[model samples]
Target: MAPSNRPIRIAGCSGSASDRRHAMAMLAANCAHDPIDVIIGDWMSEGNMTGRAALKAEAMPAYEPTFLKSLEPALLDIAKHKIKVAVNAGASDTQLLHSVVVKMVRSKNLHLSVAWISGDEVLPAILDAKARKESPFENICTGEVLEEWKFEPLYAQAYLGGLGIAAAFARGADIVICGRVSDASPVIGAAYWWHRWQRSDLDFLANAFVAGHLIECSSYVCGGNFTGFKALESKGWEDIGYPIAEISASGAVVITKNKGSGGEVSVHTCTSQLLYEIQGPWYFNSDVTAILDDVHFEQLSVNRVALRGVRSGLPPLTTKVGITAKGGYQAEMHWFLTGLDILPKARMLQSQILTLLAPHRSRFTKLTFTLNGTAAENATDQPAATVDFRVFAQAPCEEDLSPKRFFRPCFDVIMQGYPGATPHLDYRLGMPKAFYEYYVTLLPQAAVEHRLHSGDGRSLKVDPPRETRVWPRQQPSCAVTENGVRLGGFGRTVKGPLGWVVHARSGDKGSDANVGFWVRFRDEWDWLRTLLSVEAVKGLLGEEYNGKDIDRFELPKANAVHFLLHDHLDRGVSSTSSYDFLGKNVAEFLRSRHVDLPIKLLNRGKI
Candidate 1:
């Protein structure tokens, strides 16, 4: 029987900051009162994933598995209440993860709907997609080829928003489990399913889109990191409040937190989250036609905002896609050497570290120096150079050693360098200011033509079949299933062998690949690995991807896979400046992953 709206409650929990146990306990309490229709769990971050992969490669246990193992018990509790759930918990390991959740739900005799959003691995997707001549992606980081993208992906999240959630709900799955869905998508799915709204209902869709954005970052509204923390006091700090959206039929949202929890809900708090990563002027949603405008933040009550004036718009047939390619490994290190004239003191501090690093330069990839601290006025016209109060240092893996090793000098500085330097008085008490170094890469995205098809119905390895074929310039026929669509592409007829070059970008220097695959639809995500493992392209690229699950993939000459996602462009474009445009909301609903600082990074990287 289809679920008729009796005020269907959908709750999502992010596992980035808290453990799965905490999410489970909160779910247990919330479901006791209002048995929720859907529960979403998020637990992946690119930064965290990179670090974990590094740790795993080093054979050290830096990754936390509490969230990974806590799924069963939590689902069991939801099953006890006959509650359905969907979780973006395991990230790209959807197929292997699906069996686990399916078994758990069936064990309790509860129905379940599970899907994994695929195609975010820039490297694999590009090569595979290009080889199949399916929907292809391009590289963005380097104007050059990202061949390293052939490594197993570090992350593979396709950002399935309302569509996947609605599909899961339509299937009568008591629980919908996902690997990486946009935070607000589950709520949006529930609202769309309940209202039976058309894709063109821009106003209503916009309202629902606003609701998802407002409450997507649960803790933000509930006081996890509200800007005005000093103003509010929480009696039950032990248990924080989760967010809820009292969505009206017209799409207007009454954003609220759970009953009896610590946190203040005010216009300021809601506005802060809304504006957290707002970059572009417009904000978009999954429904394709929904666009937010004239977001009026009214403090109707404590922890409540009466949002109004959400507008919708027509959606393009295709959605906007994002393609991330292999940028080099970039890292930054920060050291807090607080003392008098910290600027000069830090300069000397930096020189000392550089002196040691210069000798072992080959170990490093790149090196950069910056000094930040409040300094007096120097009104010269040529730039008026006045250093910031704090000394800042940035080094890339290409120039300097690893970020970890680069920052190790801070310990040596505290122990001996600072003591021997002129600023004996500059030395503060406590440890030598443990300098923390940050590392990242600058990847690029390009555009490429592609196709979509059905799998050969031969194997189930959760990857693309390792098949090798020269995708033709002409469009190829494809097969679509109730589950999802398959993709194929053509490769250049290189002289060396029957193999093809999988280029991460369409440009002459783009990464080349011998194979590629573009798996569309959420249900078929489980078969992505097997699909990549096809016989034709087999032995062309290995299964074990690198740091990210969605490794470097090929893209069109100009844009990344995002160029192909133009179908739903209007959905991502925000209409009014008042509305908060956050990448996390967009990513959850659109890409299945919560992109931290996506709007900022996207703009900075110009993706």
Candidate 2:
């Protein structure tokens, strides 16, 4: 296929702070190779945003320090290559980030224009709306009205789109810093600018949206945090390359990685990421609603996959707003139990701790005891056979959650507690720290006034395209199972892990968890759909399934089934006390659950 007029090549350099070193490495690698039109970084995550909000509350700069630090190493190369940089690393303060970037450019004697996209912050708007009783502000996840919130919010920011970014680029910005724009907005903006696409070009925008989503996490499409990690390890995981998207004028996207870089980019890897964190087939972004129900991927060659069949339409009237507030202080302690009767030992420890805290029980708002892991049979090492018992306590004030008052009980019963009781070496685990609760809801997009400010003392207001038509929200259809595999008719069945027949990717969306499961063959789609119904999913979750609402959607083109489990994360990642706060491991845990597999499909040897 002939390329379309200088197809825009955008490289994603960063995922989050955890991948900062690798992100910088990717940037350096990109600098050494052919110049990419845009190098994007995603530094704003739920955890990072909450922390940055707290910092802003404390009168500290809202911009992320690590973002500047990571970019410094490759700044010269970036300028020399004239690679336009875009990042959401501004966190809560894009103005400060803009100034810092400008100073850095001047210090290096480099001529580069820096711009920032603002208007994501809507705390004042929210306050006004609430005071005026404009509308009943309800939490999108919990449906609880804002008036019922226990704590006043410290920060509220709506998720912006790519219009402001595109405007900045049009205004000759060499680097664009943004706060709380969707992670994929940078790539979307770059593609829109390069293609000269209008706001109504939903198809092209949808393609870029999917492409941006794939590479937004940087190494995710390059095999990092992949379900098929064993296969990626063989291809060298340590030096995994970051993802790059080659977008055609028509919106077709080719996902590839840096040449000679480690890790592989195949259909499976791209598919794994495509399914991450999505609510349903209709991916609602502020810019466009990407219809991924028909989206499919094809491997073009080694380390290259072509994304196709995606469609798009006008987005919803409202954009998501994330509000962060102080939820009080939390403290936790861990105890290790080993050998036989692990449950009994954990129970005994919990009982003793509770008995010791009986006098001070009234001070705590909530107390929890979680037992993690089980003893492994024939384990060679003692650590391998140990189970962890965790006690978490939350209170309205730090004094009530102080280590001397709350964590003292755990240490006091060390000698008299259950046999083989041991605690982790980290003493700071007993210290109380403020917890930030996240409340996500929707706000009218028209209410947000997105503006792009250029270094040349010029500002432009960017607005969403005028609505040509309004379409009713699409509801998830029932699971399709007409051609589903019938186990009884397939001779014999064997009980095994579901992973033998399906590939799954799971992630968090506020307090909810979304898990997408797909099959390699189209013939297995019905079987997958039938085998993983809502009831089946609940069963797969076993003890963790808390009888919450579960919505399922089917994607025929991808031969996949997606599920959204509401209120599954216990109140989002920041306040969640669960081990898998982000729900990153939910799919893997489900895959491990034993299920009845058809003998015929197992014998096919394609799984």
Candidate 3:
């Protein structure tokens, strides 16, 4: 299905900065491409949510000060273009968002229908169910029952999906406000409305999923956090290009930036983003499955990637839950120490430092000690020599003698306190810092669900919505068995003939692994068996390695061979044992065995 009018062109603004202003600016800048249907903006973060809650308590829009004020001119542009706007700028308060939007529409004399898509924030909803003595929603963060604890939420956003946006559109809303929706949700919603894609058309949904992944974070694929940002800046940062998505009915998405805009999109930039900040083989989505291996990016232009071969399979069985828990108290005290045996002296200082707080030590829930540029604790045969140190202590509860009081007192150690006790305390004062503790709980996707409603002119309402849950099964395991198949680390094995090298690489985070590889088309598995085998695969691993130590595998659902290797622990490259080095050996072995055929590696299965 094509758009009733022109393809219902839309623009998305990244959430990190002045989301509303940028979204408006993009629309205004591209005014020449008139009759744009929707403009989406995002401005939600943990901190932003908390800040917005505080503003609502004072009867203000949370984004009023920063976004609303900054985007006044842009909001005017919406009136001029009659462009529908969607944003999470309301943060924790959708009602407040609706009120603000209505007021702005009226003030601008724009005849725009406004709607606030709510119901994702299940904190209050779950709490209400709990008060009713029924099972409040189970924790999505962890599959366990909801723990009995006080929850002060500035925002409890449910990662809503396309259905929510469709309902907003159905309600004749020109503007929609959302809380925490998946970055892809807005794109999905827009595509769902424009193309009228069926819910069962999981393939198109998957295509939309890829499109959202590409452009959801805005400048990311357009050189914002590009690894080759240095080389791209010469093109011009003054007019940094924004990402664009050209989606078709077949669920194919071609990603490109606005023409003439700054920035370049290449294999490096696109591939870098493909694996950014991802944790597991399955890139979790609210509704559809986006098998990363099925997605391919071909450089169509300087800043374009022809994204094809994305096919949706059976949807995942679970939905992810986001839970935040209060952890403990953390205190950091930084000091400039100068002494003969400064390293040894720092060790002594930490002991002395702990002794000073012994009185209130009982109030602590947990204790940790750390130092910068020196070990906070040491073991030795003889009494430790003098050394300088900076120490930090953490506990479960920081309320009593914590952030405000206890941690700050450590700053005086060098002056009046430590000087009075030891002559070796000749060092500068330390900067005292206090930190709050936060813990995360992973609940099964089934634990948290949202209701969907069809608005009846007043407000669309859905209750006891479909259950959304994420199952936390152990990752799958891998094993290699053959006489001639050889493998080794990247360093040991330089070249291989028959074997394909699976190189381990780091994502831009420089912390997590974002490994991907192409699979030969001849490889096959029963789709039905693959669907049922993800959980069963673990059982297979358990049986094989009973009583042994192997943590987890990344077999989300397996039709093809899957492997994961932590980049840090691997020998230069994260690949199956010696299989990497056996490339040449395997080629020879297979040829000798009389199994011959032309073979090639691909980035994705097929486009």
Tens-place lDDT digits, model 2, residues 1-607: 1113888889998888666554653565466564477889898888878888888888899887788877877777777776778899999988988999899989989888899989999998888898999867888777888989888999999999997888888778888999999988998899888888888898898889889999999988999877777777678887888888999888889999988788999888888999999987778778888888888899999998999889888877888899999999998898888888888888788888888898888999889999888789878999889888888988889999776679898678888878777887687878999899999877888889889999897999888667623434334746445566665665678999888777899999889899999887777776788777888898899999988888888877888888988889988889988899889999999988898888778876634
Candidate 2 residue 36 Cα shift, in angstroms, is 1.4
TM-score, cand. 2 vs. native: 0.96
Least lDDT summed over 10 consecutive residues: which range in candidate 1?
A: 501-510
In model 1, what lDDT does residue 604 have? 22
Residue 214 CA displacement from its true place in model 3, Å: 2.1
Total backbone collisions for each predicted model: 147, 0, 42
The parts of candidate 1 lying over 4 Å away from their true place are 5-7, 15-20, 32-35, 48-70, 106-125, 128-157, 234-238, 316-338, 368-416, 419-607
TM-score list, all predictions = 0.57, 0.96, 0.67
lDDT at position 35, candidate 1: 54
- Please, what is the whole-model Cα lDDT of each candidate in the order they appear? 0.42, 0.84, 0.49
**In TM-score terms, which candidate is top?**
2
How would the candidate models be sorted by lDDT, starting from the highest? Answer: 2, 3, 1
Q: What lDDT tens digits, residue by residue, belong to model 3 across residues 1-607?
A: 1246344555656644444345566655566663355666556544344345455545765553445653556766665666656666656666665677678768988676767666555555545655775654443222235545444433344566666676677566667777666667777777777777766777788778777777766666776654345666688865666677766666667777666778777655565455444444455566676655544566776666777566665545544333333333444455554324554555666666677777767776544444334323453422232333445444544465453445544544555434323332322222222332111223223444543322234654432224333434443343421221222211132223222312111231111123322222323222212322223323432322223222222321222233232222211111112222212122123212211112233222211
Pick by lDDT: 2 or 3, better one: 2
Give the Cα error of residue 578 in candidate 2, in Å: 0.4
